[model samples]
Target chain A: MTIRLFLILGLAAGMLVADPQPQPKLLRNGLGQPPHPQAMVIEKLRRMNPEERERVLRDMPAGRRQMFERRLEQWNRLDSGQKKKLEGSLESFRTLTPEQQQTVRGLFRKFSETMPEEKRGDGRRMLARLRNMEPDERKALLSSPRAKARFSDSERDLLAEMAEKLPD
Target chain B: MSPNTMSCPLQSGNADVLLSYCAHMLDEERTELIEQHVAMCAECFALAEEQKTVWAALDGWESEPISAGFDNALFARIAAAERSSAWEQWTAPVRQWLAGDIGWKPALSVGVACLTLVVGIYLQNPARPVAATPTVEIAAQELEQAERALEDMEMLRQLEPTADEEKRL
Candidate 1:
């Protein structure tokens, strides 16, 4: 029975790894939203002449250039509120140690890839709630039965790590 | 019969001279020098004796004479193999598998059984929702956007020193 259970778990994990899902973004304004723009970089880049902008992008690999261009386009699309929310998140993100930043990135990727779509709203909401709570409150909410019913142990851990490192 | 003052050949990493001495291939002066060193060094003495024994055994061994038809027989066998049908070549592995010469069948059975079990469990659990590819693709794009945003912010932060200096002026 133990061996069979291990086999099942191993197979499940293998399937998740093998799935060709895209990783989640490290920083976004919210679900169904575009990435937040940094005012300084966007303004500086925007102020550059076309030739200067072209020169800056000329040396980048094609995919990197495209990604940068896509981001600039997203920046162009965002209104003030979305940009402000993202700026706040980005400020919090910048305060983390490099290792912590990497951990948050990994957790976000895991959440996006593994969590069910229906539960993702709950996951995001829980993350937002945890972000505002005191450490003890966060701990209480995470260990509560509501948290248990809604998320797996790993998902809860993902939320906790994100909250600790990227708290508002 | 003074103790040899030269470095031990093995210690000096120059065992070629010792090997040459064992094979009796060295000139008289070099052989004498090595012999003196070997006599004073037990490790070199053992190695030289082992090499000499190997040379003696190899020199005493004889090779069997080949039949004159050996080359022709080998060429004929090669031609016969080359002339065999492509179908037979392709089907050889399948034939081997059917004949139980391969070990993949059992492993494959176990893998299939495991996959079936996982799929059954997954389907039985209605709570586990599968994410569609389009959603994942969108998520990936969003991630790229986020990374780019961070990079843009970092670029601006690096330029902040210059911006701050301007503000001071």
Candidate 2:
């Protein structure tokens, strides 16, 4: 009798410790892949009632909550396939080492925020081209006379850093 | 040997006569016949002796007497059971409904009410709300996701690393 009681208690405790929520059906296709925490939460919010959504956002500061909701609104506008690809990219970004992530983020900030607005368009175009080139080809392009004529030394450095560090 | 000296009752599959003799229920003539068979047949004598011992034990055995007020208590329990049975019969339909055995008409009414509630809710909540919404502690994990997404979105928008970055956040 005591053993039976202990067994039941153990099972109840196990259930309490286990994750209670079921995975969303939409994310089921990504089973065996690493967990997509962002996508999971988005899917959960998508299904929530107003009361539930309100409850979830109640603890967040008003400003942060507004910003998050705006970001989420934009996220919801994407088609399912596009959402999947975006989520995949986020997951890939998350898997990178902290230092690697920082490198990429720093490079991007330099490209977008520090660069002049007039040159930002050209920078994006050049980065786009560099993204598809082979490692040796990328080196050749960065050193080419055309690249030198088009971009400053600093812009070329940024492109070189991104081309080497960014994931395919 | 006499004509009454018969075959073994056990072999004949007629052990009831031996049982009867052991029980002292047989008439005098039948008892005398069984006794004659027992005296000559060692097997019957031994079985009769064992049977006699069992009967003697049974005769000495006494059953427990009924407690005082047993009849009253038993009748009271029966009456209580009958009263409960009537109450149960009266509530059986209610129990079934509570157990979700409700008919289609009531189920349809409930479903429609729930659907109306859901539709009312969906109508009130727009796809995007411009005003600030409340936050709670239960969404700590989800809150973390939002924070991380916001941070990542800022960085990702800067990089435009993906070929289709122009098309997405």
Candidate 3:
């Protein structure tokens, strides 16, 4: 009779623990993250012996080596115009190293959680402007107090004028 | 039959004439040739059979009949719609004519009349010069005064140098 009571109690306790609330799982590398193998490899490869690292790289599958070679070839084939566009994109990536990328990602995640849908368009336009601007110009615009003061005035005037002219 | 039995019809009937006969879309000669080929060739006979099957299937498909009430319903709807639309159509032009803001003609006439009056007045009044022209002696005296003032200013400047020069000294 005592064993049956213990078993019942144990079962009740298990059921209580197993209620529908979602539990957090162990975080794994490469899960829910961008595939930036080059950065990862560089970090780890430094710890490995130079000869071992060289051997590992040399012994990489022919297909993967060919893929990397093809990527380089494709990069080389891009015209100056294409290169300039790609450089504009890469400039953003270069601004954030992996650690900064994580910080930015966390900030955006929080912002997405809190931000209203109406302000999304403003954010997109801001990002587009940042992406389009030259590096020095973007830096100056962000850093300059005068630029910040003028930005709102000019933007407001432009928006007001556009609103007046736009069709219903 | 031997391979040579497969005779080249061109050598027998002139290739161009035979080709032209074949090219004739509805000619009896082309029909006869096709019939003969179907009778003799297994491949053409099979193709004809396949085509006939397709045509037979197409011919077999019958369109579903429309409902018995369809014509009556359609006619009733069309008549009612026509009656309502007739009223709308009849009123539309009247409404437009009455409601239209046709201000341009009167506005334009007034604008033109005002413009004409202004032009006429300007044309009638030939502009005249003033009677009291400058006296030569008074003008010479004013010029002399202006020269004296300039000299005085120059003397003041010579006496007191600018702040920058004073600071340097």
Candidate 4:
């Protein structure tokens, strides 16, 4: 009886300790890759012994390692939905017409650099909100005077088109 | 078999130690130490194996699902019980008064009514008459101001990051 009681308490205490742990939010844009995959791989490497870690390091050339590290940082900066969508649509993205690709690239550059630092959070939140809206509602918003005030007529129309392309 | 062993010490404090060691929840050295102890102590070996088996069995256990109404029924029961408990506590003084035969209910009701009447009369006192709608034009002007403010609030709700929009993200 005492053993059973102890076991129950032990399990309860163990569960309490674990229940609040933060789980990595999974990306769900149709890709099967885990959230923060690059970080997870790096964490696993940190857990390895010096010899095994060195062996893994030796397996990759310095140039490859540097490129991988840079790519890892870039991947880390992408939000989960973006990461998932990019992973799933890499081939399709590459196959896009040059003009389409250039437009997408220009939009990304504007988001990364042209957007003011203070409004970055608002920009991201607005993008996420716009993505979450229904296609019909987004179309209405695109035509609304509010959007026209903020974006040029051409820019507003382009954004309305991009709404269908981007994932929430 | 020994009830306790130095190797797999079944002390109250070390209750989690064996379980942690078996589950690989401990670091390498601690796990190795416990592993050696289990190998040396037959009691601990059996306990560890038993725990592993129990865990495996639990993993295989499929729970019987309840009906959709189960949660709603449970919540209703909880709400009813809470309401009854609060009611009982609130009326405890009355119950005590009844037990003592002091006629508390009538006295309490009369006191509450008197208090309500005083407050109501105080609020409706005509002495400092609430500026009864003055000349028709000023009343209309106030109504217009109110309408303008309402329109401004609606525009603000659309222009700014309102609560619902922020929460949607």
Candidate 5:
């Protein structure tokens, strides 16, 4: 009877400590209206002269350049659903520390560089999904054998490290 | 609107006029006309104000006047650039040769092999092509030496000498 009582108490404590996954920004807040992000960027680009635009691009670091290029390539093709999903994820990403941001950026960059073209869209979608996953679910997904086999050692390690640093 | 703005006229591409107005560079007549236009148009008014601020910022910064030789210096630079460009056009091929990325090992090996082939051909006897048997050459050489010895013996007999003299000689 005492052993069962201790087990029940332990289970209750574990449940209390467990954190639920965060809702995506669009779901938590209202959907953003136009002018949409892509149009806003295109409008800003149109306003800049060649020299001014070149200077801005030159000032961006390599990681940001890759990020900008990736988003730029997707700008025209991004459906409304994908835009809403990215918007939510971007909101969560803004809350990360600079080091964490770089780690996430590098990890995504590595994933994109190594993935086959057909799988790339799914890989990007997975990254967007990560912003809303529960800590334990993220840990399970990252540590799964399939993920271990798929990503390179350095990329997997960065992800595992990211998992460890997640707030409860 | 102000009375001046009501009767004003402005045209596009008059940014230079606005700038001159901002700097008080225009004559009183033109300046007054632009000032009246600036009072009404938000865009031109903002530009004039921004250029006026630029003038204010420049007040604290002192700059030396251009030297009288500035035009001569500019002409000299253009001439020098033209001369250098002409010179570069002539030397472009030579520069390209000097900058070629040919790897040495394979190129040098081919060059050395070609040189060895040329030298080997020069040294080889055409009468006795490489395919001619070595044994045949040695046999012909020996027969020729024997024939030469026979002729020399005939010549030696012509200088006949005694055995003791031959031994002493």
Candidate 6:
């Protein structure tokens, strides 16, 4: 009986080992290979200035430049979704008004001087929040009576003291 | 000498020459080795190609000229920061001294002031009796009774021990 029980246990272990559970498979490109380098090179070229693109082509050998051009051509043939994702980042550069850009630059300078090691994510989060708000909502929040009343008596006194130091 | 002896001397001499060449600091020999390896090895050749592509991409990146006001803005920020830091540096010691001195001053001053105020109030009261000799005699008797009671209780406590405590002894 003991021998029979041992054999049963061994058989169960063998079955467990032999019949492994299937793992979820990640979807692959139909070709089962990474995208061509020409596609990546073309995307990079689109973001570069004409002068920079000319400089790179001039610096490279004819064979390498031909390879790069081939890649650029392939990148132009990508679907709209892929193209839009790459192009969307370029909009970030254009969306800011000159004055707002100046303000952001000033904020970065202040951050560097006061806290050089500060995580960039903090500023990014604040900017994201600001960007997500409507202009009217932002203005209302800044000028609210609730904001003025939020200070304690001592804090209000401190603010008054600070305000007195400011130029009229 | 045998071929092994001759080869050993040659190998050691080559190694010495190679060491003196400083292959890492002087790139010529190292570059030759890398070129040879890349030409012979598919993996190394692929890496060399990738490196060329990365270098080309890096060369293509152009940073826009910093705005004309950038320097003025940066300097203003630095100056403001310096002023803030200077103020903090100047005030920190004063703050610490004030905190340490003020923390104890209230407790000490209030205690002394209260004592003085109590004494003044007691002296101003006309209804209070001035029988100091009789009061001192009564206080001495009360203190003696309290001391005797404490001694008697201590003695009784010492004599009484639980069964477990006795076992420990």
Highest-lDDT candidate: 2
**Number of clashing residue pairs, candidate 1:** 1
Clashing pairs in 6: A38-A71
Candidate 6 Cα misplacement greater than 4 A, ranges = A1-168, B1-26, B85-169
Please say which candidate is ahead in TM-score: 1 or 5: 1
- TM-scores of chain A across candidates: 0.65, 0.71, 0.26, 0.40, 0.41, 0.27
Lowest-scoring 10 consecutive residues by lDDT in candidate 6 chain B? B151-160
Candidate 6 local lDDT, A19-61, one digit each (tens): 3223223323334654333233333455556565665456557
Answer with 2 or 4, whichever has the higher TM-score: 2
**Candidate closer to the true structure by DockQ (higher is better), 1 or 4:** 1
Measured over all alpha carbons after superposition, the RMSD of each candidate to the real structure, in angstroms, is 23.9, 15.3, 41.0, 34.0, 45.9, 49.3
C-alpha lDDT of residue A55 in model 5: 54
Comparing to the true complex, what docking class would candidate 3 get? incorrect
Give lDDT tens digits, candidate 1, residues A62-122.
Answer: 8977877766766667676656655765666667777776766666667768878777666
Model 2 per-residue lDDT tens digits across residues B19-125: 98898999988888788889888889899999988988999999999999999999998887687877787876545655656554664465566555555554555
Cα deviation of A144, candidate 6, in Å = 96
Candidate with better DockQ, 4 vs 5: 4
lDDT of each: 0.66, 0.70, 0.44, 0.54, 0.51, 0.43
Q: How much RMSD separates candidate 1 from the native structure?
A: 23.9
- What interface root-mean-square deviation (Å) does model 6 yield? 51.2
| lDDT digits (tens) for residues A52-166 of candidate 2 | 7887788789998888788777777767766666666676688789899888887777777667887666676677678888878888988999889888888888888887777
Q: Could you tell me the TM-score of candidate 2?
A: 0.47
For residues B29-99, what per-residue lDDT tens digits would candidate 6 score against the true structure? 65555455446656445655765677678789999999999999999988876778777878664455445
Output the lDDT of residue A101, model 1.
Answer: 68
Model 5 docking tier (incorrect/acceptable/medium/high): incorrect
Clashing pairs in 4: none
Best by DockQ: 2
Clashing pairs in 5: none
In order, what fnat does every candidate score?
Answer: 0.04, 0.22, 0.00, 0.04, 0.00, 0.00
